[model samples]
Target: MHIPGFDTTTIGVADGIELTTAMGGTGSPVVLLHGFPQTHLMWRHVAPILAERHTVICPDLRGYGASSKPPATGPDTYAKRTMAADITALADVLGLGRFALVGHDRGAHVAFRAGLDFPDRIDRLGILDIVPTLDTWNVLHGVDAAVAFHLYLMAQPPGLPERMIAASADEFFGHFLDIWSASPAAIPPDVRAEYLRACRDAVPSIVADYRATATVDIDHDRADLAAGRRLTMPVTVLQQDWGSALGFDAAAVWRPWAPDLHHSLTRAGHFMAEEAPADTAAAILDLLDR
Candidate 1:
């Protein structure tokens, strides 16, 4: 079922992939992107409130949710650049030449890239519960081993990760909702089930998306770093204190990419938007206003 008062659409993006997007409210435009193992419903709480004042667009990113899932042809196919273009085209379809952008997990990676690549398109940016992908991978170690197993697991060659995850998609994806959230009720029973179902149904496309990160995505990010490119607009990053868990300052790590940055830690778990919707919505509105 659709979120209350929101309408859904399946629009074809540039790369032969179609996205199932949830849209609501009216006024200035804002696009909210979802992360892994979850669909656009992750924004159910925050989007409506933001929709009160802005046009809120929530899309199941390329591989996840009800969106189209093309074969993984090559590494570049699922690159954030391609994914970022999908968002831009979605915004254009909605007649939003400039829109505020918010993303979490995998979606946040796309948002950060969108901000860098299309500075004029994403007027303001907010990333929840994640740092840059390369930054996280760079700081990995023995202590972080357990916490980051999914990254390693998904980053492996296509055959193994796909078969392993497909074998027990529910158990695998449900584990994140259980462990990553500070509270079980943070993701209601129905929503949790929906996430599991979607993940199970989209194993190949999903794994391909993750595998792209280990290869093509890293190359793009490294090239950007080499050029010293930084986000030109205001940026906000709200994350769980992985610093203590992973041993690096999350905010400090984000500063170089986003010079005009507002970064902070939250009491909520990795799914901050759901566990702390009021706070997450407030942070996002704050970013747009800045």
Candidate 2:
């Protein structure tokens, strides 16, 4: 599952946590974070393209893929604040004073937190297919919320969610891989198998990651919102047109957090980096230029 030109290694980013990272190219650094139910391999297509112009570092988020899966000892354990810190620590460990960051899905939450929490260290920010954490909760309601059933499932109490998901890990994780992509061919069979295998082995940590979003992550976002904290760097958001179907203006939702924003809609599925790597990489490169 390694990207052809990338070198993979384990780098310790926190106490007892080491991230499995793939790094390639030799220029300004850009770290790409993967979303739910997938690993750094999710960026296989897009990373190579970006690597041509920047040092592309793709890591398996702590709880997913080949990274450390510490038990969720407390709500803070998997909070986006904590997860975001891991990225900064990783950069620090790699001697990067500042770098551009781009994230998709759950990783987008982490990237958003990083942009807010460590503005000086982030040169530019790119978020794929997600609204801000607070905005996400604010926008989903009534029947429209049903589209995000997995959010509720994982947001439940610890034991129940862990047990429920573990009982049918593949089916649970595979559901997103199946339904979220408009172009199934984008994820070949081998890649799909790898994603499922990773998710299957990391159900508890994955659920813990999501559970933190419902609790501590929200608290952090609300505090930031109250403080009027915004990403100080240039930000680009590429998303499928879910706002129209779900009854909200996507650009409007992102504008407050990202004052210097470039928001565009993609015809590709939620997995835009895979389904539309050239377009995704182009947007990321454009963000770097800004």
Candidate 3:
């Protein structure tokens, strides 16, 4: 379970928020961000190898894991733009000028925005198992809508999600861990416990993150499309064939956003990085090398 050579520390990255990071290795910097129903530990299998050559940095996105999650004032608090700013601050504190970034799930949500907002700082990006937030909302219907029930559930008015999740936090969080992985053993027992613990304590902040995506985050994406602000950096998107499920050309959907994109359909489940670490790490290295 130990990530060789990596050390953990918490750093203040945004207004009243502190991010917990696991960083090591000594070459070109590579930041790895975790997604929903998980923590920075989601990268447990992939980070050590990446640390062999690159300075792999993994952080618990605010509101998850050990990060400090302050009260959300408005939609902006959980907006990817705000979350991306936190990453910029973390880089500043770590003395990194520019770096390659890899994100999975909700973390990918932030990475996509970071690539768009801080093009100069994020040199290249690798996104696993997600398209843009706008694309997600645009494609929801019938069975696909059922596939993403959590999206609609958490996106509802703040009070409802916060209360419902808090009432059965461990059960709610553990559901994703059990259902999303291709194999039940992909997430070991201890790691699964940690995810449940974190989500149980931070229900409000976690749900706010989802709500912001439905509101302000979508607005930002739509505005970017209108303004034609595409992700200009080298991008690699490794994902399940969601196009088949959602009935949209995933490549065609990403092409407009990523001018230079290497898109591949991964043969793993929703939790691809953990389910297929070797393949995911190779894809990440290829993204950075590109």
Candidate 4:
């Protein structure tokens, strides 16, 4: 129940959005973004550790956890570009002109979009357990499709996915809490309840977030590819060994987009932040130094 690094503070990031954030220590800024089915609490172990020397700002991404759930105006608002805009706006509100960015799962998708959108603002980027939108769609075929079922499921038409997810929110969101985590024992009852509640509340925005993936994300990636735009900043990627089992080298796939890429395959599952914070933190520091 007690998250290791607890520092609750609210910040008005955007219109009608007051994000619940956890700030620790004080120094250069390092914004930590949480994945799905979790919150700023997911960074409990990693944030404070980084906060030992840096000002760590971990926020519950828009429509997730304690953050305000604004109505999804359309695909534009829920686009990862818009979500990334929220983060940068939060940084500006907090007086962070530029900073390092680290994100896991859904957050990582946003971070990748942010890096492409605001290359100057992000000094270093660490994307945990994910590939780019174009890569994700291009790679999925047979068994690979099974690993990323949520991408397909959430990409459905308007009210269908939302209705289904809302029907059994806890069971829907808690699936990852139990499976993606190597040490499911680490996430106790209360934390799991909180995660479920957050997911339940943000279902619309969360669905919009993924739904944008099928549209705006594709357009964004195509534009970037055509423009020959790649992340100039150093990038560290840590993910499971899905490539070997699926018959593709994940790193080989990443090298084209990121010239300075450090890819590592971990024993942990998708939720590496909780399962292997030490390694995640190490990879983050390594990226920052570059």
The number of the candidate with the highest lDDT is: 2
Alpha-carbon TM-score of each model against the true structure: 0.98, 0.99, 0.97, 0.95
**lDDT pick, better of 3 and 4:** 3
Local distance difference test, candidate 4: 0.85
List model 3 lDDT by residue over 201-272, tens digit each. 889889999999899999999999999999989999999997887888888889999999999998889888
Global Cα lDDT for candidate 3: 0.89
Candidates ranked, most accurate by lDDT first: 2, 3, 1, 4
lDDT at position 186, candidate 2: 95
Instruction: Give model 1's TM-score versus the native structure.
Output: 0.98
Poorest lDDT segment (10 consecutive residues) of candidate 3: 1-10
Ranking by TM-score: 2, 1, 3, 4
User: What clash count goes with each model?
Assistant: 0, 0, 0, 0
- Candidate 2 structure quality by residue, lDDT tens digits, 195-277: 99999989989999989888888999889989989999999999999999999999999998888999999999999999999
Model 4 off-target regions past 4 Å?
Answer: 1-6
Model 3 residue pairs with clashes: none
Cα distance off (Å), candidate 3, residue 269:
1.0
lDDT scores of the candidates, listed in order: 0.88, 0.93, 0.89, 0.85
